[model samples]
Structures are given as C-alpha cells and as structure tokens.
Target: MHRIVIAFLLSSLSGLAFAHGMSAEDQARILNAGLLEYMQLGATHMLSGYDHLLFLFGVVFFLTRFKDILKFITAFTVGHSITLIVATLLEISANYYLIDAVIALTVCYKAFDNLDGFKRYFQMSSPNLTWMVFAFGLIHGFGLSTRLQQLPLGTDGLVLKILSFNVGVELGQIVALSIMLVILAGWRKTASFERFSKASNIGLMLFGGLLLLMQLHGYQHTQFPDEFPLNTDDHFHIHEDMEAETSPLTNYPNKLNFDDIYSQDEVLHDDNSYQDEHSHDGEDFHSH
Candidate 1:
C-alpha cells in the first residue's frame, strides 16, 4: 500500500508537466484530421486531464444512489457541453493558464465541500452543490475550449468537429466515472475508509492547491517573460531541448520538426512586435 501510494504520487507529479497542453507532435498530426481523429484527441485529452478527474471524483465521492449520480453527472455534462460548443464555435478565448488555475480551484472547492468545511469552520450551510457543480462545469468547458483552440481547427465542418470532440469527452467521462465508482464502492465497505475519508479529502485539497500554484507560476512566465534571466526565445529553446531529451521518438528519423514550430512562432512574434513599434511611433509623431 505504501509503495502504491508513493508510486501514485510520483506519477502525478510527473504528469503535472504535460497536463493541459498538447505536444507539438500531436498538433502537427492533427493539422488535417477528420471528425474521428478529433474525437480521439478529445478522449485522450479527458483521460489525461487530472484536474477534471479530481473534480468529478469529489462530486461522486459521497453519492451512493444511481439516481443522484445520474442527475448530477447529467447537469455537469450539459453545463460543460454548452460552453464547450458555444465558446469554440464563436472562437471566444482567454489565457489558458488562467482558465486552468480557476479549474484547479474548482477541484479544491469540491474537495473542501466534501469535507463539510462550511459547517465546521463557518457555522453555515454550503451552497447548493448541484448548482455549483454545473457552474464549475462551465468553467471546465472553457478550459477545454482553450486547449482545443491551440490546434489548427479549420473552418470547414467546424460544428461537426466540435460535436465529435464533445462526444468523446462524454465517453471518456463515463469510463473514468465507472472506475471511480467501483473503487469508491469497494472502499466504502472497508474499515479503513471510515478512518481515512477525511484524510483523503485533505489530500485532494493539497493536490488542487499544488496545481493552482503551478498554473499561476506558468502564467507568470508567459506574461512576464522578460523578468526571467533567460530571454523568451532561449527559455523556449531550453524547453524544446528538454522535451526532445525526454521524448521516446528522439532517435526516430521521422520525428516532427520542433525547430520549424518555434521558427513559425518567432516569425509571428516578430511581426506583432514590428507592428506595435510602428504604431507607437505613429502615436508619438502625432502627439508631437
């Protein structure tokens, strides 16, 4: 049991690095992908989305009745689906790091609610949990939309692509929920569960807090790249090098060209900088 716990912790820590971002290879492969491929991508995203899974776990932690489970889960599904489809279709977006930070908070919120923190600490009742779950689901869907936008989603068949991805997310959620329910059901029968449920929720909160901090740290790096000792270009290159070192396809002859990806990004950044500089110069001349 100790070994299992340690192993799980190690895996989770490592997974944090790759969470919520697709690899360059994945992006490249999906450039001209069809609906089936989009569905696969969506399924893969949900499976790897630890924050989403944690929130779902907290939601169903104490729910034993199938009716209650179906109701809450359906509410969550409808909520996220509405945002996921609408946001992506309208091309509405925000900083993904910030969105994910909020999502991490949702995980913490659910876990805290699970522990009856409101009644214990504040002598008050918790808010309507079903409504809260639905609200958080909207935020979660926006987070998903942000990630999906990173791909080259073409205008052709856009609605179909989005629907396919949403369907895949539901499928992935079903699979994850089944496994969680089975585990919870078995654990509930054990004496250890009575002793450890509180501890488990506390652990969930800690994990959520950790994820929140990491996302904020990433946001800092992205928004204030100049504050770091390394220039933005150098920092990104270092990241690319690290990815290459860790990638299993490092020696593969047909590996995707990460340099090309960076080069394209550099071009776009330079163009934006050029336009901004000229615009500022124009304003200065007019002011004078």
Candidate 2:
C-alpha cells in the first residue's frame, strides 16, 4: 500500500541517524568530529528526512525560477539554521517529540495546499502558506540539530559540525530538487499535465495530512521544559512543558480522571505505562 511505502521511506531515513555508524568508544574524543562525518550526516539527513524533503518540495513546488527558489530557500535556511546552532550553543531547545510532531503537520499543510485546501477553506491569497512553511522550517531545523547532537561526533567542531551539516543539507536538497524539477517540467510538456496536476498535488497534500495527524497524538503527555521561573541567565527556560495550551488531553483530561487514572501508584503506574507505550510510538490519533 502507499502508506507502507511512505512509512518505509521515513523509517529508512531515521535508521541512518544511528550513532553506531560512528564510534561509540570515542565518546571522550571532543575533537573527533570532522568535515567528512558532518558531510555524510548532512547529506544523509536531508535525503532520509522525508518530512524535511517534503517541506522543501512543497515550498519550491510552485516557483518556476532558479533565483526565486534560492531566495525562498535562503529565507527558510536562515530561520532554521539560526535556531539549530543556538540550540546546541546556548542549550536552548524545544521538546524533541513535540517539534517533530509539528514538522509532520507541516508536511500535511503543503499537501493540503496541493489539494487546494486553503482556497476551499479560506479563499484568501494575501497571507499564503509560504510564510507558514517558513515558520515550520525553523522547527524543522531544530529537529535536524537534535538528531545531529544525538550522534557521537565530538562537539569540538561544533560550529564546523553545524555549518558542514547545513552545507551538506543544501547540497542534498539541490540534488533532490533538480530531479523533481525535471520530472515536473517533463510532465508539463505532456497534454494530460493539466488533467493530472490537481491529482498529484492532492496526493502530496494527503501525505502531508497523514504526517500531521500522526504527530499530533504521538505522545499522550507531551511534556517539555516549562518557562516559569527565571533561570541564571535572566531568561526563562521553556523546556518540555512549553506546549501548555495544546496538551490538554494529557494534563487537563488527567484532572478529570484524577480518580480513575492518577488515584494511586497501582492506578497511576498503569496509566504511566500506557502513556509510555504511546510515547514510544511517537504519534497519536484520537477519535473526536
């Protein structure tokens, strides 16, 4: 089935994030990370990152000019790369599970655009989906950095490591886009192009929608650092608990089920166990 193929593709990318591919014994080597490794990681993540690739594909899917694509890509690159580096440098990062969940939603956004969801729903053009995609790119960049940090590569070349990874990402993206452009152009040359265009975009939108929904309920209690009390840097630290408004299912609903779910260790332990199972899957789907 189509879902199987897409699932396989995503799993293939995540598999490449294995730290075992490097050296586990070199944990002490702070300067061990090199250009070659970052290059490999960058290229690997870009291609393997089904969500990221789909986002980029959606962003440039409409633009027909090289310069325009570069401009758009540049905006997105800057937005995300800034946060990615800062996350590692200042140790300021968002919840890993939540960010990824949002990235999945972005894929759905693009697919929805392809299917003309916006026009049918909002019927507006001034504030389009491009800006939304760019904002999501910021989150996506952090997602990339998070995966990179998980690797054993020495942080000594932290700057270089991040930079090299960014470059490799762009390189890989160019390669993917080039092929896609060729296919689109060729398709345009055909007579049935117009007939199939809507369907193709719809397929992309459908894929995006599926990714979005998958990530929303990925974890039952999407806990992260909360920005309540100020930190030593005079800046509030918003760790895993930053998503307060949206995580009612985990926090609010629990208040309602305080007796049933969180009544005692015997009850709470089982509830935690169930949540852990859902969190491990890292995606959620609930019936309204």
Candidate 3:
C-alpha cells in the first residue's frame, strides 16, 4: 500500500533529473551576493525540494504527541545542521545522486518503519532506527550544502550567509511541520482515518521507491529525477505568428487576412474605394 503511494510520488519526482532548478553555476552566483539572496536560498531550497518535504511529511504524519515529535525532529534537525554547516564551511563534497538516492531510501525506510513492515514481514530486529534516520539526514544535509557550495562564495561573510540560510531552512521546516500537523490532526477526527490510512502509508512507500529509482535513473544519465513518473515534456515553445495545428506554432492562424496586420491609414484606404464610400457614409451616419 505504502509502495503504491511512493510510486506515484516518485513518478512525479523522476522528472527532477530533467526538471530544471537553479543550475549549480547559477546557484553559486546567487550564493555569493546579498543577504536577501542568501535568505531566499534557504526558503527556495526548502520550497523547491520535493524530496525534503516528502520525507518531512512522512516524519510528522504519525506523530500526534508534541514531545515525541519535538524529540525526533530535534534529532533530525541537529543531524542536518551539523553536516550542512560542516559541509559548506569545510567544503566537503560527495556525489549528488548517491546522496539523494540514500535520502529517498530514508523516506522509504521511515515510511516502512511507520507501517511496521519490518516486524510483520521479516520478523527481523530493526534497532536504533532513529540513529539511522539521523545518519541519513546528515547525508541529505550534505547533498543540499554541496549544491549551495556549487554557487560561488567569496571568502567575505561566507560563513554567516550559509548559517543564515540554514536557519531559514529550519524555519521553513517548522512552518511545514506545523501545517502538516494541523491538517493531519483535523483528518484524524474523521472516520475515514482508519480505512484510508493504510492506503496513505502505501502511498509514501511508493513515493520513496520512485524517488530511489528516479535518482538511480539520473545516475545513469545525469538527468535523473529522485522519483518516478515518465514524463512527456516539461516545457513548450510558442510562435504567435503561426497556427497551433497547421503552422506548428503556438498561435491561432487567422486566415491570411494580411490586411488585418496593416496600419490604420492602410486599413481605411482600399483599392476598391470602399474606404472613400465608408468615409462619406460615416459623416451621414454621424449626422443622423
């Protein structure tokens, strides 16, 4: 069940490989200048990152208790923060796809654990899952920081900018978590919670699987997304002058009424002398 959900999500994400975001070079330019850009990076990274948000959604879904949520989230936060800072400051790097692939697996692992699949399917011991979660988080953090580093960073105030951006990421996560909690709590009040809940878990599993495969696809092509969904096209071009169907352009083909593309004077003056007749008729019409 969770697998199905994961599949759909990953399908959507698989487009990530081809789905354009800030290029590493472009991101470096943004990273180098202005506090505004730095702050925006934090917000943008969180906003644009589907994988991060999906994992976060999985993390918070089952947590109804505040203390428990705080505890686990704090651990995850600490893990990410440590690496994000260290990675950016120390300039350590790793392959993006592998890290992202692991991150996708983290989503799968967490969702599966939440579903208690291990206890049911394998009858095997899965110990210290939180620790595992934290470790994976470090990997995810490194992936993000590496992307940030790809942007050119002048030695001037680099540390401060990265710190500020990371802070923004934390803030964005908090906001996202709060919203998810509010929505999930509201949903729990309804009767469908039990009936559809397993299905939802299945969805998460599927999303994770797709992301994992999608990342793998990118590794194969360097254009891999972190999830699955075979895509047709992400962008389109338009030419206003041509008809969309026959002309192979984006615009409607008005019948070759070249006269329509004329100046006011040209339009008013015709070889048939209709313009002269119309002008004479206009004065009469006005008088009437």
Per-candidate TM-score against the hidden true structure? 0.77, 0.62, 0.69
- In terms of lDDT, the best-performing candidate is 1
Ranking by lDDT: 1, 3, 2
Q: What is the lDDT of residue 172 in candidate 2?
A: 81
**Candidate 1 C-alpha error for residue 63, in Å:** 1.0
- Ten consecutive residues with minimal summed lDDT in candidate 3? 234-243
Query: Across residues 1-288, which tens digit of lDDT does each residue of candidate 2 receive?
Result: 233323433553453344211244333342465787677667766776777777776676667788887777777777777777777666565656667777777776776666667678899643554566568768888887676666654447578777887888778877877766765666566666667566655665666666555555444335432524355554433544565545766655425555564467587566666652234355774322
Relative to the unseen true structure, what is the C-alpha lDDT of residue 106 in candidate 2, on a scale of 0 to 100?
A: 75
Q: lDDT per residue, candidate 1, 1-288, as tens digits? A: 323333443454466867657778778988889888888888888878988888898899889999999989998999899999999999999999899999999989988999999999999999998899899999999998998888888888999999999998998899878978877887788777777778777887898899999999989988997777687798899999999999987788886889999999999887766553334655653221
Worst 10 residues of 1 by lDDT: 1-10
lDDT of 2: 0.64
Error of 3 at 222 (Å): 3.6
Per-model lDDT = 0.85, 0.64, 0.72
What's model 2's lDDT at 11? 56
Q: The CA-based lDDT of model 1 is what?
A: 0.85
